[model samples]
Target chain A: MMNSPICSMLDIEFPLLAFSHCRDVVAAVSKAGGMGVFGAVNLSPERLREELDWIDAHADGKPYGVDLIVPNKFAGKGEKLDTGRLIDSIPQEHKDFASGILAEHDIATDELDRTRGISGNFARNLRAEGAASSLEVAFEYPIKLIANALGVPPQVMLDLGKQHGVPVAALVGAKEHAVAQVNAGVDILVVAGGEAGGHCGDVSTMVLIPEVARALKEVGADTPILAAGGITTGEQMAAAIAMGAAGAWCGSVWLTTAEAETNPVVKEKMLAASSRDTVRSRSRTGKPSRQLRSPWTDAWEGEDAPEPLPMPLQSMVSEPALRQIDKLSQSGHQGAKDLATYWVGQGVGLMNQPLSSGQVVQQFKEEFAEAFERLSASLGD
Target chain B: MMNSPICSMLDIEFPLLAFSHCRDVVAAVSKAGGMGVFGAVNLSPERLREELDWIDAHADGKPYGVDLIVPNKFAGKGEKLDTGRLIDSIPQEHKDFASGILAEHDIATDELDRTRGISGNFARNLRAEGAASSLEVAFEYPIKLIANALGVPPQVMLDLGKQHGVPVAALVGAKEHAVAQVNAGVDILVVAGGEAGGHCGDVSTMVLIPEVARALKEVGADTPILAAGGITTGEQMAAAIAMGAAGAWCGSVWLTTAEAETNPVVKEKMLAASSRDTVRSRSRTGKPSRQLRSPWTDAWEGEDAPEPLPMPLQSMVSEPALRQIDKLSQSGHQGAKDLATYWVGQGVGLMNQPLSSGQVVQQFKEEFAEAFERLSASLGD
Candidate 1:
């Protein structure tokens, strides 16, 4: 196997780190030689423990990781607001707006699980204390790495990673953020660009990788960087490595994998969508998050629409409605189908067909080899 | 000298294409072993001839190219609208808004040159017929390439390119646009990302290059691509090539070069700015063009501000105010200094100091070599 510092550090065959929410996809990717990082943002500590247990049994002793979202700021952040209070804090106007949109689509809002079974736990889990519970559970498994999205991982998260002998990674959108992460003692830097799915900043991946890499090198920090955002193929991975990244950290590509638990309707949209189908809107999380553009997104962008509320509040407004939409869309409601959307990058245009998680990894290996060969071939003797 | 297909095609020592509006910067870049493409959108046919004549005299036998903005859609694109007619079409409200901005800053709006020297010629030169006149002058010189921004080159431009043995290139923001350009018989594709300066699309360079490359290859089109947008260094140039591009077509990097004609105040801002300092706003060109953020941009984005008039009309309103601002800012006026801005990319953050055009080229070569070596080192035997 080709060796990189990240591969050696993580003890993985290839340096490709797959970010997915599906346990099956995570295990399949790890078994196929790449490190599968299960996104644990939406899971309770008990559910997370159960999910990690399943991956531990299915991953065949391969190294894997977990990713958690411990943002630097969110609604009721550092204030300790309970779920009922947080929910109450949401303005009736926003709730009415969300419900109004669903009603327009003929989807019953009551059928949607507003509390998602964790009634007041959503705000708690996103806070430092809740992340600790999830982290504690994650460390119980034989995980090799842990990553935080949205901002620098808290010092506690970093300290736990050190105590558990696992490396901690932080995702940054710009060079200064990378510098801050290094100052915070992050073990790995996942430099994601604006083209990335989920939350992203305006800087593109092509410029951000080299920008972060050069900034780190200049500051005498040797932190390994994994380039993320809008990257869907082996050639892109090879391009990232060539540009000074340790590897390519991918998320959106896995959404179409056979083992992914993505909404079937959304997956079909992703398969049929072009690069232009995605838009970076704050409608989902209150911060700018790239997702497939639908009537739902369009309505939010309309002139009369109110600006999306900040994180946690926006999630509260969107998730219940979207969950209802996903369920109805799956059941073949025409309006729900038209209004369906999910987090995806512009690379969705290229993701035309569905492949198994293992197949995707295998193709990445081959494509990366081919791209490397092409680059070497360009360097004439 | 590094050899690539684009280098061979353009007959340059390296595959780096420097896009600059300054003739001196263009000539210096060409003399430094890369192709310098002079942006001729703002020049009249007679002035363009003079610029090309100077480049031809001073380029020292190195190949250079010319770039023109013959956009597919613009104000009075098909109909022949004379300059007075075009300027007369500007709404009183837009003119008042622009003048009001200058008034608020204590700058005398009446002293500004409303005609900007070219008079009605500005609208004329952007049309097909006007572009043809400039093309006639460009072909008179020993030009090796010609490119069109905003859309595919018209059939006449393509035919003229073929007849003159100059490869015609078009800048595309999406894969579908690349296919359209290839189908339009364009010889080279300049895939620009949203991070690019001036006009850009939503797709980022990291995703756009590989996306266009793969899309073209899938359709059996072997057109060479010149990766562009927010690219400011040799390492970025190396990254573009590794992602299957034949070369890097950079624009904003030259704005800070010692030989550039960029406004002195704006140049200083570019030197001190970070990647996040630029914002894509239609307030400048009526189409979203990335420029340095200032009080001018902020005012346009303000709630009570009117929407920027489309293309030519917006230019009419802004050009008068900005030209006045640029002149006063250069003369040490405090209010003008705060309001001055210019077209630049996100890469402005990396452009810390002013260097000679030749030094910038030399730095790129060395940085590219270092990056290439780094990639090879990562590929273990």
Candidate 2:
């Protein structure tokens, strides 16, 4: 039933919103009738433009959104180091540690050359400028909503969304943070629990959803709360709505979909994985991102291995090695496969079959409706 | 640092008490001057006598406890079913599903021999009788405390503990549950969060600890709280104490210790595992237990596999398969190795090397002292 305020506000068939880094998944979900928020963290200006343009042409005028990762604790306002300088300031010990592990695994050390200067996900320099560019590109298309992934949306992003007559959403891990986002003029709150993929804080969705939603209401805020993390099936989506959330926001489920741009080798691992297969480790992005546990993460976990550098510094140090791991894994190197990892959520265990993103959306709708009927039937029973 | 009144009240060096099923780990922790709570879920009366006798002999006359898994939920409230009757009642479809998966993995189907009787870490009976023998055996020992692993200690257990001049404890996963247990005459509240091994409710330690401790204080309940779950190092113990917990209780850390009767093959995996390597799955014992993901879990997650049976029923259906998997895994069967799983916690990732149980306790004490000093230094800075 579209009785949930989030579903009514978004005018969707169900209260499930899928977040994905792949444009194809976004387009498929939007076309299939649930809102899809495309993660634009790693996309270049041109690549983002091409993606939005494609969505605009194919979405059948359906509502969709864009997501950016702008955290409150970014290399904050002090003497700010530029990307190149930050890269240089990383300790040689951390670099040596990463390379040494790669060497110990018998991976070609020479492949490290190809990984140099590779800018992975997240903005490394002048993130505000990049966020503005992404906002501009998204607005040029008919985007209905925008989200800041890691923390509160910037005042500029909020103002831009307001000017464009679109909703500005913020991803938050705590109730206090949700209140802050609402105070800062966010239109929607995406409450992601620790069971989520990518960046998350330690709170489970079953508890966090109602807590954040209740906090928003108590504070005289009506910002629709979209419960994120660990939501994989339609029943879970129904449960989220039942738990006072306007909708369920999902990401990891998309990685197993046919439209996902996940590495083929890693995708195979994910397909073979259960929801129990994921771990929250900083080895990938230098934040507590839930990912598939591969030997790469195990190597960093050893006592002798240097402690992971913080945030961007750790990401910068490990990205080169990870890129190489991906390349070698793709080529079917046994050692590299052992070292390869991909970001995912605890919901991975529930995802046993590969479905098209559209099929996923459709199944979610069917399941949501079935669950609603089951709940209703219990009253009579 | 050990001057907390709860410590003296509980007759322990620190209020922190690790709850586990292994007698060796329990004795080791008690010998190290902290308390150890032995989980008695799987022990028969004779076996438990031997364990308590061993603990009494080796614990150096220090305070220790016994923990029994008496989940508030169970099957057959009015009448008890015989083992043959319960086994016969298991849906053939579930048995077929288990057989098919084992067949696919090339694990011997003969290992499902029904004549061998029920197997696993708990008795097959779904009645309170399942844990009764263990509880009776525990009362024979001079335990300093008696705890219920899954819920509030039964009134009989509390009465028994009171009769023996020992404290009764109950494990709670939520703050609300803690408040309820405190009102129910529990002298000590074992707060186990989602990151803990075995059955854990969905709440992170960081939030759950403060919430429960604060709630207890607000209500004027003097129930001593032992923070369990993901606590591994002494620093975490300090952090829990800082959050108003008397001390920290641990399980996963002991699983990697030399004195632990942990599955040797599984211990090897735990040695290399990180905090992220574990998953909360109901594949074991029919409740959500944090366990390492193996191919057996993955097999059950597949499309054709029946959804894991609920609680005791599921545990009943799967334990036979798991026991066989463990045996094959020990024999170096590649398929079974992939399928073998173990109960663990997020703390597994932090254990870089195996140490004697005594040495592990020593490190915890040393680390705890250092962490406090670090915090105290930060205060001056």
Candidate 3:
């Protein structure tokens, strides 16, 4: 069979799209013939500019993409609220809880202040500004695509892509959401189901792919669908294509690549994780995302665990705790290290070893070929 | 939340039934208030009689159950093939392939004859004989329930249960499956989803529970639905109840219990396993079952690996490999140990420690109570 239109059109050998904030992985995956999507969520404008510039120079002329988090659901949207007002709107109890957790870990109070405002409108505004600046950096290079995660891309992102003659992709979970993205002029739809890493919805890819593909066709929308969630090997990709997806979009498999910017301690945990090690919780981004269930997630569960605040509010409550935990984890603090968690997909279970991005891509091709041969053999009399 | 009717009617305090072949765990879970359903699939009639006798002597008058694998879909109700004829029907190449793998692992070939006639008629006969003997032993005691695992219980099992005035339960995966069981006159339906360990169907607990509940309501079938899959903690039990399930049917959680028959080495792996460690593959049972993905599973997945035969054919291929691997794993042969795999649920990730069955039940109660309180606190706010 011919490669899926989405994969072929994106000029990648595999439909896999590796999402990471690490520049090294972006460069590596692009070099390996799978698209690397730079996560622009946590980057500052200047930092993103530098990172994109680095990727542009180091990506070996292979195509790559950029991922921006633009939530369709957000607090204070269209209110024109200032950062101070939004910060003030956050409950003090939540802040105190985060502070007390960090204090218990013996993180200095001054460093805590530096971490205090790590959330709120400051981060949102930074993400927004960073997206815009990163768009400039991306346009300066030969970027293949730009994807908006968590929501529909703003009109400016679409316009920027149009102006650059590049495809603007949108990540969506539900079929209705896919239709909305298609209506919003999204060039490609990254259909992520509940089994995907990070923020996801409540549908498995087995059901979600065909549902979205049929929905797109019925609406006469030509938007190509890239299936995401719990997909790892070539056989899974073949199954997704057979189910009507234009291609498969992957993330978790790349998290353990040689170039990944994963926490050493957390990476060790991930190396041993099976497909069942994940839980979908809103503790991270205020949206339900699958991550390795560590003590940190367990704390937000069970009795006595605080009720996770809504999306952005939840971020304010947990981000500081995460920051401190990561710091102590880096320094070999055992208890804090046990609590450090990272976003991963259920497919992490299939990623049994750490290989270079190029080796991973090669393995997929080999596995895919064998799987197809087996399928054909089974079909024969 | 009130306990489900299946539990209440059966006089069992909890709906979570720990299904296993181990006598100690069966006895422990029964004493812990949760019903234990002993899997009689592999047990010989005499062995099953002995185990049931032990349970009868040890069980503290708590309600318990027995599980038998009686496939609704199987070869020859009318075809009427003998065990020897069915064994002859299996391809010689498959047997040769299995032999090569076993020999390569240094497993004794002397037991090959004993292993060859496993799964299909072999399985059917074993379960039927064992179930009959188990039923005899069970009837001698105060057995509260009897369950058919793979499909709706045979009419004989239902008849026996009816004669004994005990409820007959059937395990199902989908809403339609639940309806079928209910229509077949099943008194209890264990609605297991894809996230569950062992042999299961394609559905998640979140969507499956409500769907099955709605289906049963629409069909006017009052058969109680016990939600199974990915349920470990009491909070999950509460959530399952909220989703209309009478109670949670759990198994993987009990595998790590102190009295479990799981290999100590494998138990260590299970303890360290995050939710991501499981995969649904038919390599073991010739029918899909959620299992911990180990080097054993990886061997089956490789290009050089023999394609697993279907149903009874594949069981003959797997039983010997599993037995040999388990033996070698105990001896600390790293390669053989690596190949050791076990059927477990996605909830294995929640089992971080080896607790007694009673401790697990107690913890579930505590967490469930807290979750209810939290939900109540959020109400009328």
Candidate 4:
């Protein structure tokens, strides 16, 4: 295997970093020689502990990591608002708008009423106190790295990473963000472009990766960067490595994998989608996240539609409705099926079939080799 | 020098195709051993002939090409509407909204009134008959290639290209589009992503280039692909080539070159801007085109703003006001300076300095060499 610095640092055969919320996909990828990093934002402390314990049992002695949502700012941030206070803060108008949309699709509003007071996991985990508890549980396991998704890793998180001898990573969408992360002592930079599945900036991967790489080198920072966004194939990983990324950090590609926890309806939709099917809308998480374009997104973008609320508040309004949609869509509800969508990159167009996580790892290995050969062939004598 | 099929086909020293509207940039880039393609959408047949004559006089025996906007679908496309009819068809509300915006900036509305009768070159040339005139003028010169910006090249264009021993290229945003073009007998594919200047689709270059290449290969098509979108530097060029592109087709990077006709105020803003400074808005072109985000775009995106009219109609509304803004901004008008924006890609963030066209090409060569060396070194024994 072609070795990169990140491969040695993370103790993986390849530098590919698979980001997934499902424990099975994570363990399968790790066991297949690529390091799997479990996304822990939606998990409670007890649930995270249980998941990590399971990974520890089945990871086959391969090093794996964890990702957390520790943003610098969120609703009820510095004021330290509890879950109940946060739920109480949501406006009735926003709730009504959510229920109205579901009711239009013939979905019962009773489920939303029951879940209204339960609060959302994203809202709960994004706050300072909530993220701290998750971080505490994460460090108890042997994580090779820990990543912060929304912004620069907090000082406490950085300090904890240092104490545990684990490298800290942060995702950046621009060159200036990469510089700030490096200055903040981040060990790795996940340079994601706008074409990435979740929250992203407007820059595309082709430009952002090399721009960040050059900026880091100009500042004399030796931090390794993992290129993300619209990179599903091994050929793309090879291209990113050629652009100065130490490895490929993938997220959306795993959503269609056989062992993934992705809703089967959404998975099928993703399998049949083209790159243009995704739109970067603030409807999902109150941030611009790329998700499949559906009647739901179209309605949010319509003339009379209310502007989506910010961050956790928007997630609060969207999650319950979407959860119900997924449940009904699986049972063949036409309206729910039409409105069902999920967060995915433009690479979803290329993901036409379902493969086991291990099979994806093997395919990545073979494609990486072929891409290297192609590059070598291009350098003619 | 490294050679690809496109390099030999175009008889250029490098596989870099510089797309520009300025005659000076075209001649200079061609003289510097790279293929320079003149963007002919904004010029009349007589003006195109004049520009091509200028390029022919100064190109020093080097070959160049021309790009035209001949989309399959446009306003008044199949109806054969005259300029007066098309202008008369625009809604009064849109015209009033556009005029009010300029009036708020303290610019005189007289220039707009005078130009109201004159149809925009974009609106004119996008029609079949107008494009035919432009093509006739283009073929009078020693052009090596003719490209369609928004869709498949018309049958007449393909036939003319074959008769003249020149290649016909079409820019596409998706692999499906590439397949359609190949099936339509397009000689070359310019696979551009959402980050490209002018008109572009939602796919990022990193995914689109490889996807198109693989799709073409699967279908046994030998069409060469030129990767575009947010590709400003030679390192990015190397990355694209590694991803399966035969060459790099660049546009935004040339706008900041010394010979470019970009408005001075907007050029300064582009130099100081980051990737996030640009937004894809339909306010200017009636299509989703990426340009610098200014008060003008923000106002159009506001709640009270009318939905932007389609293509030529929106261009009709915006062109007059923007022309006045650009002219006034150059003369120290603060409001005009604030409102002045231009079509550019996210690559503007990396363009920090103004270099002559020859200098830019020389830098591309040096950067391309360094990137190749870096890739070679990574494949260690």
Candidate 5:
């Protein structure tokens, strides 16, 4: 029941948009009155089609969206490496280091090839050309929004969004990037802070929100802004609105929800972790992404650690090892459990409880009302 | 104009608190219906007394506070190095690196010892013992508040505050530290985030304020929180309050004001800088302190740069060369002008105009009301 422009632009009752890889969470949040955005970066084109099909039917015709990773730049983007040579491109040193991490955890690193479920899709989604297949699937659905998590969305995506009457949102961590995205014809900007889980610049949301808003006004752009990063509560949503964000775009808050696709082991770690228990490192994604502090992450930050390779190359080394660790951890491997970690924001401290996706939406409405009332009270003298 | 608890506690008309090293800024802000805190960390006891005397006489009986830097941990805390030994303790390698940066910028590396005004006072104030002398001077004045910048205030500061019926405040960058400060008898918590000007943790103000608020509630402490870091306007102030901060405590906003002690060269750079320009590096004080981007800060973060020495030793190497650079930059030296920088926050992007201390406070009130109106308008829909 917020009056931010985003609510009407997206045809959602509330301005909160939950981001998750789980189709169930997306459908539930959309049905619960808030928009649900499915993270499709890890899904194959076929898988994405099926997920959107499921969400379309299960979302009860409520608004839902899809998020694709189509970074403007990545390693081997120009070279156009096929899957075979791309896998071969990873240095043996990095391979050993990633494998060595799991080896130390007493997990067998010999069977790293079992992670095709994510690697194939991740490699395919590493660039806009590959992501076009997924976009084709997303556009076919009756979606209200589509977002790009890294860099400015390509001209093709913007054009398609215009054709379909769906808004194209790009996430930015700095004001200049926000300006650039707006100039690139992005309909909405998710101004994320450094405390965000995924790739982010050094500016904080508190500063970025106002800076982007003022910069947008200066440049004569009316693009709406959805605040992201470290926002897990409705009170923070109100704060975002006060700072000129039209609404909140939350990602990590759903990671530990009952219907989330998060690895059970990592979900438990996230629930127990505090704000101080995360570090922004490039080891996982070849960009500074915030992840829970664990033996695996700490080793990469150590003095003897090699500089992480660029994205896709770094992902080739990390995802397989992490996937193995995630599997072994669930099957009674204590060392793997100790070394396991996943992307999470500093707001993990505020997300200790597990709730249904719809329940989380309900909780947000109640808390948002409480926070608004509190601010209204402050207006009195 | 607002009913935040900090307003009543500080006996100010607005909940805004201006932090500045200039007594003029402090006096002006307090006289303009807000609390003005005098940053006394860089002042000698005699100088502190003189400045306080000036403020007391000129403040027109308005409320004001004093801040001291008594870090919980620093290099050479218990060693009790005398002036001669402390000066000698700085490694020549660091001295050469610092001198090399200035020399490359065409500033003279010679005469590094001429900075007794701040070096001697700073050397003395490196520990709680030296800070106690300044505290004694501060207690003699009718200050309404006393704050510690680095860590929990020592027991004596707490005891003295209770003895004098003055509120003792402490700055915390994390939620645990906030809880510990409140439990240590501090009446107020300055929850500074990584986006703050000086020493700060990696958590953003958007996350830290709510994290600290929930932490204090969990610990059953009712200590009031003043949000700091990346906050420069009344709209951002309202956002901080909406996130559960009692009020906004701003430092960077005053650095470029007419009455601020900022060097003209550095102030110009800050005015031109965006939120992306600052870097949090240990090169300044052997702690992650945010400062304006300049050639000087860039050199330290480059490859092959030596690891910054611990606290006071690093300060010794940095302060002399920076003081020289600051002097030459104002005297029409191009290279020195390019090298000049100062502590600031990401909020520096929002601080483009040069207003008086009183005008900044007045503008904050107006912007805050407009933001409240915007939020209330949202509630109507």
Candidate 6:
């Protein structure tokens, strides 16, 4: 039954929350017992509107949420720059580094200059000002929750959440951040550990969970925590719940699922690779992020590599190059395939099989019950 | 009863294993419900024998274990270097770097040179050839378990365990290491994650436990796993067990306990530290290990810092300096106190109080029950 406060708060059967960029995954996971949160970082206001509209149709009267990157602080936050200006502001050396990596891999670089114009707009939307339009579009839909990552939920998001009567969640990788989010009137804390797929801090979920839980108690805040990191199996979900997390918030486990829009080559790499294959480097986002290791990441980590530029700029440089890599790899380019990588957690080692989102949810339930039964046996005797 | 296969195998009521360097802590925890495994790294053969003799007299018929650093590979594995020969082999620059840091703290570095003579023997003893006498001394006692870290239990230790009817356990940080340990016939795997104190791998316990458990299953091994990392609470212990561990192996949780031989100044620092206060660096040991963040660790991680020497050599350089830091800090040297640090996991945040070892074991039982009740309530409906 997994009757957590979060389950009731979100009006979902299970407390499990799946975060994915693909609308199909969000709809499918929500249609299962778990709630799905669509990551709308790169999605434009119009694009988010379209994705949510699709989710509304496919979600089968189930609740879903939206996640955005309205960080409390970032590079070029206050400045108003058009997509072209933002792309132009990126260092020439950084652009050359990105293009050179692709060139060395024998892939096309022509599409990167184009991808910037598109991804550039999304990168600008990462600020509260830019994200406001997207959130306004999201509020028009029936989103059960709204979340912010990389920092505390901005005041605009908080005020908007209050006005709409929707819970506001913030992702935190450390105990202090969790306390800050709770103080900022965030309703839910996505206490992610260092092993989480995208942006993350250095602390692990095992330590961070209890640390956040205790800090909340000390601060007299009762904010429910959703443990996120290398959670793949139902037992891990159960383990998180046991360690003071109200539920489990999983992202990487779904990337290998059948409903995921994950690049096929990268998915295959994840299936074959050990947990050691992922590197937490700032090359992609100018902030530490866990991703599958490939020649691209290796080159960035190499001694001769240039320092990654800050936030949106790093994303601007990387997203375009990676998008083309995905395209070429899918089109049967061996060099592109060799250089392909994707955001994933250490849990990639456990996600060996490709299941549907529904099947994954079902397994989580069954495995969860089995884990309890195992615990009961050991504890009972 | 917190009974599992490990409990029955180790003849303890609870599966919680307290790892400490102090003989009193080992005896006190063994006297309680949990088994304490003494860290036997720096203890000389005669010193370890005397410590075990004290534990035997005070353990009140409870089980205890001994842990040594018998790496499968190291810098001076086959070398026949005595204490003086080993001390002379350390690079002058590294010695200067460590001592210079102490001098900058306005603390005396005079004792460092003398401490190295003693620590040099311990560093040399980390390899199999030098550890043979220590193991022979330990075998003379009524120890229930024998364990090794940094690598697989050496062939000599494994053979000795087979002959002596003692279970040989090995500490591993990754799934591959766990499989290798099982193949090497290690009866128990202390799966210490990156968040653990002392020598560790980069994988967190939450990820490593399930990963190692699955790997062991694939290899058809039924070795019991003691999950070690940022485990400081009963709920975390339960979570470890829920995530396929037999029990929890904790070290940092005890450093703040009343019985711990932790330096007084350092204990206060740990009590006040946040989970983020620990730094995982290769400054102290040749390999990466988590320790409290201080000016000492800060200097090593700085841009101008020299590369840490390999395994026994790094230990030779840092140990002597740190030992003097501890002494000066204890004598009320503010600068020394500011620069003082010791090995501790990220779980230090939860260890705020100075409870006795017995009280800690009792709280763990109560906490375990409460954690289970919490899990049951969530799943009961």
- Number of the top lDDT candidate: 1
Error of 4 at B324 (Å): 1.0
| lDDT per residue as tens, model 1, A47-149 | 9999999999999999999999887766678887666766777788888888888889887777765554233555666778898998889999999999998
The fraction of reference interface contacts (C-alpha pairs within 8 A across chains A and B) present in each candidate is 0.55, 0.01, 0.00, 0.57, 0.75, 0.68
Give per-residue CA lDDT, model 2, range A1-381, as digits (tens): 355556666766666788988888888898898888888877877888888888877778888889876666644323344567777777888888888878888887665642243363245323677667777888887788888886678788888898998888888887778888899898888888787887787656644665576567678888888878777777566555655567788998899899998888888888776445667777766778877877777777775777666766787778888888888888888888888888887766557678999999888777665645533332221
Q: Judging by DockQ against the true structure, name the best candidate.
A: 5
Task: Show the lowest summed lDDT stretch of 10 residues, model 2 chain B.
Answer: B372-381
> After superposition, which runs of candidate 6 have C-alpha atoms over 4 Å from their true positions?
A82-96, A108-111, A114-118, B82-96, B108-111, B114-120
TM-score of decoy 4 = 0.95
Which pairs clash in model 2?
A274-A349, A275-A348, A275-A349, B274-B349, B275-B349
Q: Residue A75, candidate 5: how far off, in angstroms?
A: 2.0
Look at candidate 4 and tell me the lDDT of residue A193: 92
Error of 4 at B282 (Å): 0.7
DockQ of 3: 0.02
Ten residues in a row with the worst lDDT in model 5 chain B? B114-123
Greater lDDT among 1 and 3 belongs to 1
> Is model 4 an incorrect, acceptable, medium or high docking prediction?
medium
**CAPRI-style grade of the A/B interface in model 3:** incorrect
- lDDT winner between candidates 1 and 6: 1
Off by over 4 Å in 4: A78-93, A113-124, B78-89, B114-124
lDDT minimum window of 10 residues, candidate 4 chain B: B113-122
List runs of model 2 lying over 4 Å from the truth.
A76-83, A113-126, B1-67, B70-381
Query: Deviation in angstroms for B39 in model 4?
Result: 1.6
Q: Please rank every candidate by lDDT, starting with the best.
A: 1, 5, 6, 4, 2, 3
lDDT of 5 by residue, A244-303 (tens): 888899999999999997888899989888888989999987889999999999999988
lDDT of 2 at A17: 82
